[model samples]
Target: MSNPKPLRKAVLPVAGLGTRFLPATKAMPKEMLPVVDRPLIQYAIDEAREAGIEEFCLITGRGKDSLIDYFDIAYELEDTLRERHKLDCLKALEPSFIEAGSLIAVRQQEPLGLGHAIWCARAFIGDDPFAILLPDDIVQAASGKGCLKQLADAYHETGGSVVAVTEVPREQTNRYGILDVGKDDGRLVEVKGLVEKPKPEDAPSNLSIIGRYVLTPEVMPYLSKLEKGAGGEVQLTDAMAKTIGEVPFHGLRYEGTRYDCGNKLGFLEAQVAFALERPDLADGVKTFLKKYIDKV
Candidate 1:
């Protein structure tokens, strides 16, 4: 078989209203919410860059212009920083830079579903295998390779679509897309089928897909049909299920800690966890946490 085309592009679906964030998201897009000093969307872009993604297609909605503007060169701000000789501030902005035309943002037009959001970028993806990463699912890989890179590596060997997955509690199967396991080699499992948000008793296995996906262009035709599945939204899982036998599909068990920043508690937990990982703030944060524990 011919070698699979190198994955060059990534799609990020950022059209959600972020209802869980309430007043904070009333005006600001949730993707702009900072996990520390950097916004959440920046982390996702950083991950894609690490995986060798050269082009980015962001599925945006109304009031998400800020997401597009974040990657643009800030001429006024740079001029001010240069005049003030604030080299440190200028250096911090380096990571946000994207190649002149590498970034593209497409409007989703409605609050449909993840499937529809992905479909909106079909033109941007063209005929190449592409990746999809949800900004809300922030994954920190223990190997420092990022979750997308892990799936990309597996895709190279398997020559088909690969999705990052982790074992969730049996009772929590309904919260995610559960996979029907075929062959398991500990790290990679052959995907026989997929069930979107299946009841615990009906779930095929405990392993559930996360946000990182390396999908072939073949799935686009299925998504184009706009068939609504669970929750009355066009479901990506349902579309993917139709391609099970047509192409080689597998679930990769990535080594990482995933934070669901879409929820309030999870967002707070990620903030504290990320802060503790930084050498500059680890000691101070640990001391404050101890004091709070004593007070409580």
Candidate 2:
């Protein structure tokens, strides 16, 4: 068997209209919404960088130019910081910098779905195995590696395709793409089948596919078919399901907390959870919570 191609590129589908966030997202891309301090897209980029991804392609839609502009250098801002001798502030901006030509932004002409959004980056993806990270789902690893980094490690070992999976309530299976398990070895579960939003009775397992995925190039042709599934949108899970028998596919039970920033409640919970994790804000946040609880 030949060696697996290294994962060097990551695709971020940031084209959603974010109807859930409404007025706040009216003028800004939902990917630009701040989780604690950093934007959701920034957190996704940071996770991808942890996995040693070299290039990034952002699949965007109308009114999402701000997502691309975030990576570009702001000369005036840098000059002001330099003049003020704010060295620490300058250092903090390092993550926002992308080497020229390494980042590409491609537009998704319509709101087809996740699969179509990813398919928009075919030219940029070329023949390499690429990772797809959805910015709406922000995952924070409990200890060592980020969610994507863990998936990347698994992909390096098993090759083909690897996706981050987390157990959800069986009743909620219809809300996500449920996985059919072949083998379970604690951390990685061999993907025997994939069901896009199956009913609770039909779900094979509670392991629901999240936003992080490390996929092989072989899956692209399946996506190109544009077969609408589940929500009448070209689902990425449907295309990925086609690759099950052909390639080595597995779902990783990553060690982390996932916050679905796509919705209001999950977004609010993420802000508090992330704030509590930071040493600088933990005590203050805790104190405020306690005081607020006493008042209530």
Overall lDDT per candidate, in order of appearance: 0.94, 0.92
Error of 2 at 68 (Å): 0.8
TM-score of each: 0.98, 0.98
Q: List clashing residue pairs in candidate 2.
A: none
Winning candidate number (TM-score): 1
Model 2 TM-score on a 0 to 1 scale = 0.98
What's the CA error at residue 6 for candidate 1, in Å?
Answer: 0.6
Specify the highest-lDDT model's number. 1
Q: What is the C-alpha lDDT profile of model 2 across 81-180, one tens digit per residue?
A: 9999999999989999889999999999988989899899999988999999999999978987899999988998897799999999999999998899
lDDT of 1 by residue, 50-74 (tens): 9999999999989999898999999
